[model samples]
Target: MSVLRSGSPHRPARSLATVAGILLALVSLLLGLPGTAGAAATQRAPEPRHPEQDWAGSQIARHEGTADGGAPPAAPLASVEGVDVSSHNGNVAWSTLWNSGVRFAYVKATESTSYTNPYFAQQYNGSYNAGMIRGAYHFATPDTSSGAAQAAYFVSHGGGWSKDGKTLPGALDMEYNPYGATCYGLSAAGLVNWMKDWFATYKARTGRDAVLYTSTGWWKQCTGNSAAFGAVNPLWIPRYGSSAGELPAGWGFHTIWQYTSSGPTVGDHNRFNGAMDRLRALANG
Candidate 1:
């Protein structure tokens, strides 16, 4: 009637309650609330969520099939391509590797405590000197005692990073190894710290950051947070399936995605790595 109170406590409380009610109404609309309000709610609701928006797993699941629903599926990522050229059997022939769509090759250099690849030195040299964009991998030393040493050994023996600054970089392979009893004993944090030490030494020697090669099990059990390693250090994730969809959500921005192990090989037993764009990027970069 006359003059309104300067600062009415009740007015503020009423305003807050009104705001809360509006928020509730909005949420109810989004959730398709029932009753007469539901019809009006639907009209003002937000757009339907994209399949890929909520979860990466869901995204992969949704896009598992070809866009046209054909039997032959398309590649998930458009940009990176890669292949692993380890000393599994023997050296990888560069010419054959290059010809078979091998863009970037991650050569296995060293393994955990006391188990080094005898062919690493020669193979690494051949790959690097032969004008191939390369990355080196140390088959993770879970035994913390020799982690730093193994890393140093890798850098010293693995031909370092490309002199021309064109290679996919280095990595620490942290998958389970059945033979190494000592390695199998360490806790997750112990394994992670060992990798950290290894990568640090490797970087110091080569002047480039090393990638962290791990599977989903290793990531969850060992590394926990994908973002814990930061954005600069590239991640090489391994998933054995038709789709790269099984990879972790935060890991969508991985540097190298090992899509398949059954890729074409070069020599009698030389298996090729996967990824076209990844290889090209490494070479060009």
Candidate 2:
């Protein structure tokens, strides 16, 4: 009944067509269809990550060995036997490990001042009760907190060394990152300085040089194979083979070698590079 104006009869259809075009564009974006901005965004690579879990050799085997490979079939050498354990090794049968001839152990104590192994007391005390020379280790997260702060937290928790013959010096476990970049996003110089802070602070508190745990490849790639701590810190090198392999730069010899990630009886077993007396000597000092 309305008087027609030019282009008026088609107005509703044009509006509906415009709305349909908008809806189609939105659908394309949601679907990340080709030639769309959303598609471009989707095509960008994802950031690197994993569920972070810091431990002894957590990332070492992954980066250093064949995919998911276990320790070599070769039998361990005749040396002072040891083990390194973390919270994952819950309620360790310390007596069984002792019976299996594990004379020494290093238990994960703290990580980056934020995490204290939930099984720390059980593992640390239990290992000692079974007559194994046990030490606490701190998994270094250089990117999370200052080295000094982390060191203090470690000492306050359980990473303390004593002259007690049954307790070995606390060790610092510095290896590849489990969650992010291999070097924890720190440059070689920065990482070196960070560790110096840790060493100095730990020495100041416990009057002991903390043992250093790292792989040769990581040391080279991450720290430029800096040998600054080699003269003081005992190196705990990890290589799952018949031999300990070439050590990282600066150390004349490795003190302890984590030779197997998959031990027949215990968890990960190590071999102190000497006899029981020398093991006791490390504990005493």
Candidate 3:
């Protein structure tokens, strides 16, 4: 007769149920039960990051998607057309590019002190032999070695410049670091100093300033848009857009604009700021 317990509230029972649910969740998580959060998290391996795949504009294209389709903008009547290739391009058909009216080219030659482009000779020499004013570029990996050391390595490889009217100055492909931190884990001031070392060493070795290939966005994030190298380094800005778009802090004008990665022919398409004479003048320097 005293068994009637309906007068009591269910708060305690509800609390016990809540505790039981929590325990069950914990058990599933610990066991990585099928269709649970832990299973989803542990299912796949992360993609491994590797070098050599880090070529010119590779990071930029990853961060900022390129326009691979649609009608390309008409080349400026007074502008010179160009292309840039890397080992990723694998022995570019320079003859075909020349027939397509491409007048200049840049080919990646080195990355840090550890790696060199396997197809560099084919791309670098083939472009010149095809009668295009060509140059070599080094993909900067500032995290691995000192800028001066990397510079030495670059010149010892094919990243050397000449005064020949047919050769353009080597370029420092200093875009976002493909392997790690944006500025190679450096402070803004540190980045500037590192660039200084690279430029000095490269100038001493080649007697010509290396061209800087970078995007304005990366410059802002990595170096706080420092204007230190603008005056001394020729800017080769990559902008896949309707126009060349706004440049970084220091450069008032761009020497070359890589407007589209997916051009009609091969490699990334660029435009020299002036006509053929101006292109030759820059090369002669």
Best lDDT among the predictions, by candidate number:
2
What TM-score do all the candidates reach, one by one?
A: 0.61, 0.79, 0.80
lDDT per residue for candidate 1 within 1-285, as digits (tens), equals 545588854443357777777877777667777634576756684543222121111122232331212121255445434456555547667766666554456666665444455666656666667656666676654643467888777676663676455565667776654344433577666666766677778778877777776656546654564455645566666554544345543555666655544444532111122355445554444
After superposing candidate 3 on the true structure, give the runs of residues whose Cα lies further than 4 Å from its correct spot: 1-49, 65-70
Cα error, candidate 3, residue 108 (Å): 0.2
lDDT of 3 by residue, 137-197 (tens): 9888787789999999999999888887998988998888777777898888887788889
Per-residue alpha-carbon lDDT of candidate 2 for residues 85-183, written as tens digits (9 for 90 to 100) = 998888999999998878999999988867888899999999999999999999988988899999999999999888889999989999998767889
- Structure candidate 3, residue pairs in collision: none
lDDT of 2: 0.86
Candidate 2: 10-residue stretch with minimal lDDT: 66-75
Worst 10 residues of 1 by lDDT: 51-60
Ranking by lDDT: 2, 3, 1
- Between the candidate structures 1 and 3, which one is better when assessed by TM-score? 3
Count of backbone collisions within predicted model 2: 0
CA lDDT of every candidate: 0.55, 0.86, 0.85
